[model samples]
Target: MFTEARLYSPVTRTGDGDVTVHLSEEHPGVRDPEYRARRNAIAALALEYVPGAALPRIDYTEDEQRVWRTVSVELARKHRRYACTDILDAAARLALPTARIPQLDEVSAALAPLTGFRYVPAAGLVPLREFFGSFAERTFHSTQYIRHHSAPLYTPEPDAVHEIVGHATQLACPRFAAVYETAGAAVARLRTDAALKFLADVFWFSMEFGVVRERGEIRCYGAGLLSSYGEIEEFRGAELRPLDVRAMGTATYDITHYQPVLYCAESVTHLEDVVGEFFATIDDETPARMRARPVSPRPAAAARPRGSA
Candidate 1:
């Protein structure tokens, strides 16, 4: 089981002149040479892309297009049923093509007017600072490769479908966009690794795996849930606790399986007010102060973060 303390596994090269993209055991095409080459090549393209310049283009193969369409259509159904109203409204605005994979440049162009955010290329692990810090400039460094075609519905890592469909959908939503913008601004002020990691954990819970109650139903707004074909259906079954910043910052989680715990906002406005406000004020001192608290309250429904005895 993996936690979100650091970047996902890095890409490595072997003496045999082959590349290995570190992935979870569930990754379907791990042993496929073709997929490995394709992934490594696209990652190279991301490396060459210059910040603030036009993003590099990716020419998807027929098989890759098939993979995109399959996951797109399947996740669409799950999104409508499981997604929050604002996220669905943003999806309507995006009207992303289901028949083909849109290049990151195109995704950037579409998102420009909506949130002033743009997609940039990312080969592998973008140092945590540059990755999240770029948000202050409204840039998202996204991975270009599609997941292995063998399992269109699942990916061991964040692939194209997860980046564009999951995040682009929410970013186009003004309410959610504001949340990220504030987060970006927060990172600009946070210099310590302790503080930045604290912010990322909160985001992982609220923006990545957060749920909210609306009209008497608990539905999802997080990108991790929106784009996940299988996990989206299972989050409602995870332990649902009310939003609590202290619990979230210290919480540990396994990234490789269905998340066993999640936080819920009382409503969309509550999520925006609570999480958004916290993001707006994070600083180097915030982490130390939170940890120094004499008696931090426990999350009601979920167990302690990963590694807690």
Candidate 2:
């Protein structure tokens, strides 16, 4: 199935005239011709309805600007404390470029070379299957907007704070990149909805909100925990158990409340290995029902009455 891209137009006001920034349905500044062509094809599918339609203008008031500045400062402070220095040093050693609230163009240029992944600035939420499909094809969806200080601690949906500060930094690592790509591939191969639901549980538990032990200490790794001010403390200090997928079964998390527990991994490599193995094992198993089906009563000769001595 083809994915549709949504276009957005963000506006800024000045003394002279309103300045509008358009995020084209078509991704721009992608160096690879083949990658650009693939995005263009997707865009063509998206624009069947949009057809170059201009988006509604977003006006930023003085108060909004102040809120944004304050939020940026707070985010920067958190970034300094939580960001993995080893990852940053590795990125720098590899001469990987960095950005503060990078545009899709910048992310696309950086990621496309490492993997075929390119950034798409989503207008709203995409279906889980579609999101997984994009990852299978090495495309990462991101939102263009940033969260404001008014809700510094929480946002209903992922803004640039979670996308850039939390997710993109880890994408720079090669091992983590392979893990994500493999998980996406597994998601794409599953035919049944039950299997998808099970895998999503696995993803939610590990990839989005997992932690790992390093040097005899627990540390924040998952993007969800890293981005959230409250979760970071809770995940590290609270009760955590080893993630045993087979025993625990599939489960969903409460997004609004601080997580009471988190899964711990021996190392990042071990986490990747375990996920890969779990998918392989589950792919072969038939989904078991939680409840038994009713059966009709048997004949007197074939069945014994209850409590017969």
Each prediction's whole-model lDDT (CA)? 0.81, 0.53
Candidate 1 accuracy as TM-score: 0.91
lDDT per residue as tens, model 1, 227-296: 8887887788788878987678877676756778889998889998889999998899997898777655
- Highest lDDT: which candidate? 1
Candidate 2 yields a Cα-based lDDT of 0.53
List TM-score per model, in order: 0.91, 0.65
Model 1 segments beyond 4 Å from truth? 1-9, 12-26, 294-309
Instruction: Put down candidate 2 lDDT per residue, 191-276, tens digits, no spaces.
Output: 77766666666666676677777777776666776566555545655557676564223443445455555677777767777865
With a 3 Å backbone cut-off (N, CA, C), the pairs that clash in candidate 1 are 252-305, 252-306
| Model 2 lDDT-worst window of ten | 300-309
Instruction: List RMSD in Å for every model shown.
Output: 3.9, 14.7
